[model samples]
Target: MAAALSLLLWAGAPAAAQRIVLPTGEYMDTTSLRNPGCGAPFYQYYQVKGKYPVASATLARQAQAFLQQRNGRYTGTGLITFRFGIDCEGKRLPWTKVLQTDAAYRPTHFAPALVEALYAYLQTLTDWRRASGPNREPANYLTLLSFRIQDGKVVAVTP
Candidate 1:
């Protein structure tokens, strides 16, 4: 009877298992769900709360600024892939680095810049799991971005 009651209470708890209690008494949990595309594009900033010291908006702005400043005066297209991980404790776990580099001779040199900017943006989100890899960096909150470049610009990006 005691075990049954305990189980019931546990099940009744919130869906977020690792709720981060903030200084303002707010709690944050990393939940996995797809972002339903509304009128605008989906960004990690809209999804996380108290998951990182920096806000998601700030990160996005930084990434955009970086790209806007760097993507100019370049041409061609390339692909960039990155991987990182997060755990139930909201801590970024160790993973592999899945960085793919294509030389300018193959396509263009703008691939790495787009990737770095995407990662800079990801540095601001919370509650994500990157696939386990051999050379991945460790963090409490993980962010992964895969960018598709076209015409010397990033045409599409995905988590």
Candidate 2:
């Protein structure tokens, strides 16, 4: 997956920020490409490479704002990792999973709320520009979203 990440980062650089027109004729900013996570055999099998699906900056900012609003009401610190996939049809494949959670925060009452909120925010995202292989067939891509919260504030959100 290192190769894929490298290609994505390279194509996403400011100098290479060309607009990629999808099969559906939607224009996507190359810089919006995100790091498709590793450790998934599906990615290797499909030979998926380069940029992955990502929300527009405006939508991403809105989602972050929503998360921050929800985090403001919580009282503990923790990290949450969410995994999901985007299918060839440019639809979210209902394969969401919680990859990890801090033990202290796992059993908290607000834990479910946080998870649900993130899921909801993800659902609000538009369809991604599908990844294609050498054959030009669209392939599914795995993605990871991580949230780090501290003292009831969201400290970071990583790809």
**TM value for model 2:** 0.54
Q: What are the TM-scores, per candidate, against the unseen true structure? A: 0.37, 0.54
* Candidate 1 lDDT score at position 101: 37
lDDT of 2 by residue, 1-159 (tens): 335323432122221223322332211123334335422233532356423345334444666698776653654477655555665655554434454345365523234555567566666655555667556656666665666656544566664
Using lDDT as the measure, the top candidate is: 2
Q: Model 1 over residues 1-159: C-alpha lDDT tens digits?
A: 434222221111132233222232211223333222211221232133213454445544555566686554435466554444344334442231334334342432343344445544454445443222223322133455555556555555553
Off by over 4 Å in 2: 1-41, 44-61, 68-72, 103-110
The C-alpha local distance difference test score for the whole of candidate 2 amounts to: 0.49
